[model samples]
Target: MEDKRADVQELSDFELYVYETVAEIDKAGGAANIETLRNLIDRPEEDIWAALSHLVSANHVHSTAKGFTLGPHDWAP
Candidate 1:
């Protein structure tokens, strides 16, 4: 399987931060939603949503009923 880190080079600074934030929250056993991201990151709702969209489209993140979590590649070896 492809590694997600390889795709990080293509992301913008904010996008990278958002992706990392989602991973961090997931690592801590919490799901990340727009509200959770907004509260953690200092960016506005629009920017966070945009970043989430990009990350999801890139397959670096996944949106589920629980919330946003890292893609399979991110968690797998």
Candidate 2:
């Protein structure tokens, strides 16, 4: 059997926060732009940008016309 668990990666606290922010955006029936995400996370804009960049690259998050969103990997039921 394939070990699916091994394919999962760990997220740093900030990265997890960034991902969760995007998830909340999904929950609210909308997306979040960088400014809105910044306000929600209360971190330096640069840091948020960094985390978002990484998330996007990893396919854990995605970018939308409105802002950021959870990538397919993080999609929920």
Candidate 3:
């Protein structure tokens, strides 16, 4: 298997959870809005959104009027 340590070093467990959940949303052809994301993931609202903020700043995810999506690079920092 490919080593994922370098790719995911910066993300906390919850953040990884959020990121993966977002990917799932993408696979399902759905956007990850705050309300929907909250329901899909098991983390607390604050923690989920907090991870999302980090993901956005790192360019690993992007947000739109509709919702969040996997960013330009899927496995980037």
Best by lDDT: 1
| Candidate 1: pairs in clash | none
The best candidate in terms of TM-score: 1
Best first by lDDT, ranked: 1, 3, 2
Residue-level lDDT of model 1, residues 13-67, one tens digit each, is 9999998899999888878988888888998899999988988888888999989
CA lDDT, candidate 1, residue 32 = 97
Tens digits of per-residue lDDT for model 3 on 6-38? 256788888888988898887788789999888
RMSD of 2: 4.3
Model 3 pairs whose backbones collide: none
lDDT of each: 0.84, 0.76, 0.80
What does the lDDT read for residue 15 in candidate 1? Answer: 94
**Candidate 2 local lDDT, 1-77, one digit each (tens):** 52122122566888888888888887788887988887888889999999888888777776888888766653354
- Name the runs in model 2 displaced over 4 angstroms: 1-8
Order candidates by TM-score, high to low: 1, 2, 3
